[model samples]
Target: MVLAMRHGAHLIWVGLLLCCMVDMGATMEFTGAEGQWARFPMWNACCESEMSFNMKTKSSHGLLVYFDDEGFCDFLELLIHNGKLSLRFSIFCAEPATVLTNTAVNDSQWHAVTIWRNFKNTTLMVDNEVKWVEVKSKRRDMTVFSHLFLGGIPPELRSVALRLTSAVVKDHVPFTGWITDIKVNNTESALLNSAGVINDLCGAAANMCLNGGVCNVINDEPTCDCSQTDYQGKDCSEGKISGFSFGPLSVLLTISNSSPLTKQQHDMIIYRFPSFQAVLVVQQFTENADILFL
Candidate 1:
């Protein structure tokens, strides 16, 4: 009995190992090389079902995209639609039309795109920033897709079984970069898996720096060196904040006789900065307010 139990336990261990191997082998990568793409065909019964999806894309340039097919509703494409470098949700022939955000996305870095929809409402987020939102009282038609195409396809080719490509085109540009960490409906997809993969490509790439900042890696950590300039922060994102005297400038606030606030009356003071300089709003709340500037 003891020997039989031990044999069964060993079989279970072997099964677990095989599962791990399958998971680790699921991450697929494609270079932005010409004419390359990836497709995953799935057997989804109710393919038109609404889904909540989270996908991450790490690209240095160009647009990232994906396409899905839903039989009756036909097709849906998530891309930088209408030739703009912004995120768009396009459902072919849908009544409400395609939705898009004004935020430019060709920044050549890692960006996380999240889409959530329950037929009535749809929300999209990019790089932890909510890009677009729509709420409707009536439910919308969704795609009943059996396959997903990652990059390369004409928007009109819904029923066609065309292979994925890396070729560039007018309507849709093939994604030429790395994509990972994708989850649908809180469940990880086998085709979009990134288990046990060391994603050091960000560090390996030559021009990871932006805005002329120097890129360097120290002890496995990547850092951008930006020094002695008005542009502050690690990525040199902050604009120039100079031209003012260095030391701490003191100011005295005196209530204006023209617009004086009565006792026990609260006043709100708001300062709007000029357009040429940085946009800063200084608001003050007081029983008696005073405006002071040097």
Candidate 2:
């Protein structure tokens, strides 16, 4: 049939190029001198598989968001405003999340940022597609984790790295980004990998989420009175893990020799073998005897 319809259209174009080669894995790596800058805290983070950055702002340029008392902070900002590429994705620790963009941000080269999740929703990818998402209701503790911090912000005294070639001007390597293949796709639902994480505060490490109630320290960034349901934010670190229910013969076997028979000698061995005794009596005496030799 015409060579089987050209080999079934070349096997459906090689199965759509292997479903666009799904690869979301990068475990963090950065190299910045002349004023060093590197910060990543999305709880258990190990992202950075691709990176790129270069700045020459004539104006508008600030990403020092610190909400020690407002909301759980989702105030995304990536500007170049008026000229374009002015993005915004805020939540005020409220409903349905927000996102405002100015578009066109390919500047000089390499650009990829992906923070996908499951168990519900939580997406933010620029290159692999999706650029905004956060539809949470009663789930924020499934814990795949998300509390990323890079090249600045969330720093009280220092750390979060960022000195930037002391304002580079040589051949211009400025912020030559490199953050590769970071992945977190909860198969499509694990509450979208629960956006969460929390690290030693009071001592100060910051980065905890949960907007609705409790988790307050209002003035130093930790304000989340989101109305509680038993989950605030930043502490879903892989969700502490929990799951179990097995029985197909649930074996633990190991009581080979036990003795303690009194009370009329255990009712004369259960009335002298009452058809292989199965008289259940737990607590108040605790006794179980099984002896079969047919």
Candidate 3:
């Protein structure tokens, strides 16, 4: 009886791993934007500083995630339509998308804002809660890697595009010690079975445009800013092979929240598309590849 139970445990673990496998993500990974943002508020102690979201292109797309002493999220819009971020998994957050005032953690301690994505939803987990439920969302689309905004928007949206600079010191407030860490992960996934896996990916890859162009990501072989209209879409993988590369074939793209692939991500990509031609395209990329890939 003991041996049978142990075997069963192993299968369950394997099953969990399998669910993550179906979530092979196509992302532009970035890292070490981790750690602390320098204690400089934008401009002055109390000023509306512009922190531009250097997107897939130089032009603005829309707002996604914002951090610093004050925080706001433009990505939580999906819950209205999808019902939940995921039916297979649950996430928790102490100081979540409540407000930029940093009350989500409740203890005033260091907290993490985990934005989780699955076939059905975009769940924000503060720390880790077991009984977590869906929260109101504003994200229009969900992708493997998304464009994020820090600081605040420039007056470009207004007339003060120049004032939308990064956080700087102001009055007596100093904008100091406002510890904030913003990171995203594909993290966990839920697969009902093989059939559900495929169904999920199609829906997962199936464009929400939920938050509108306000928030978007790099999945489905996405691409942006095509010259002369040769290519377009989230991953640049959508165009015809007609213009299939006789040129220099060099493109410079940025990847954010990146890391070495777990065995699962690697294998899933291969299983899904044998023609991936995987290579080490600079393991530590430093750009947000998903904002609005139109």
Candidate 4:
């Protein structure tokens, strides 16, 4: 029995150590120079492909591309067009539906961009900001498509690429920056397995939680649950309302006048219905008074 217990404890310790290692090594570094791009196979991006990536650009005016497939100029792709972050969806050479941010993204800073589709609506997120828009056009079958190029478009002829003859090539410009933390359909992609690349974001390692709250990753998004009952906010950064206390059948309230010379009138009216067993309370207080209800 002793040996068995020791072995089980050892296994648990090893598992925890492995989990810590994975959490620590969760981000990936992308060198967007020298025509370097990540390639995800066709099977990985078939159908409605949702993508989320964090990037820091070395230069401002370059492209931040997500997908580059032939035959359609837009059809299920995300890119930075004319400095605006744009998400485009096109079908069978039809008029492409696009969602663009009002502000420009060529700020030479780290930004998180997420693009996903829900029925006809395309959702885009830049850090904490989000924009959701429905596409007027009908959805088409994209399962037949094969392969997707990330960060950079595929070069023509594979060697000694010709000058800009096709307009498509010119538009499919490569991103020049550092890209990390990429997810597709809420799942981490295998293409981010480059050297010195971490799997998760920086928050996964430390300080994601605040005020003793627990930090959790939901759908690749970091969220915090405030530990104290009187604390609230995204990272438990704000204080919660702790003014009122109510019993099963009673409520307590206290009010104080702000100034000695000022006359403050406060009224709390309650209406009770004996037939319905319902009660409603209306409170009117002056600005000079501080009221606390428990």
C-alpha RMSD by candidate, in order = 20.2, 22.4, 21.6, 21.9
The worst-scoring run of ten residues by lDDT in candidate 3 lies at: 169-178
lDDT per residue, candidate 2, 152-238, as tens digits?
322222331232111111222212233333333332111111112221221152334322233333333444433333332344221
lDDT of 2 at 148: 36
User: Candidate 1: minimum summed lDDT over ten consecutive residues — where?
Assistant: 192-201
Write one digit per residue (lDDT tens) for candidate 3, span 58-91.
1111122332222222122111111111112111
Candidate rank order under TM-score: 4, 1, 3, 2
Please provide the root mean square deviation of candidate 3 (C-alpha atoms, Å). 21.6
Mark the regions of model 4 whose C-alpha exceeds 4 Å error after superposition.
1-34, 43-49, 66-74, 134-141, 156-169, 192-294
Runs of candidate 2 exceeding 4 Å displacement: 1-4, 7-13, 23-85, 88-294
Reference-based lDDT, each prediction: 0.45, 0.32, 0.27, 0.54
What lDDT tens digits, residue by residue, belong to model 4 across residues 1-294?
999999999999999997774454244444444444445544333345577777765444444544434444334656676766777665444465778786566677768888765545668888777887665655543322434456654444134333222234345556666665556776765552121122254246458556666543444455665644446777665554445567876565543222233337334434344545656454445655444332
**What's the TM-score of every candidate structure?**
0.41, 0.19, 0.22, 0.47
In terms of TM-score, how similar is model 3 to the real structure?
0.22
Question: Using lDDT as the measure, which candidate wins?
Answer: 4
Clashes of each: 5, 53, 50, 12
Q: Candidate order by lDDT, highest to lowest?
A: 4, 1, 2, 3
Q: After superposition, how far is residue 259 of candidate 2 from its true place, in Å?
A: 29
lDDT minimum window of 10 residues, candidate 4: 192-201
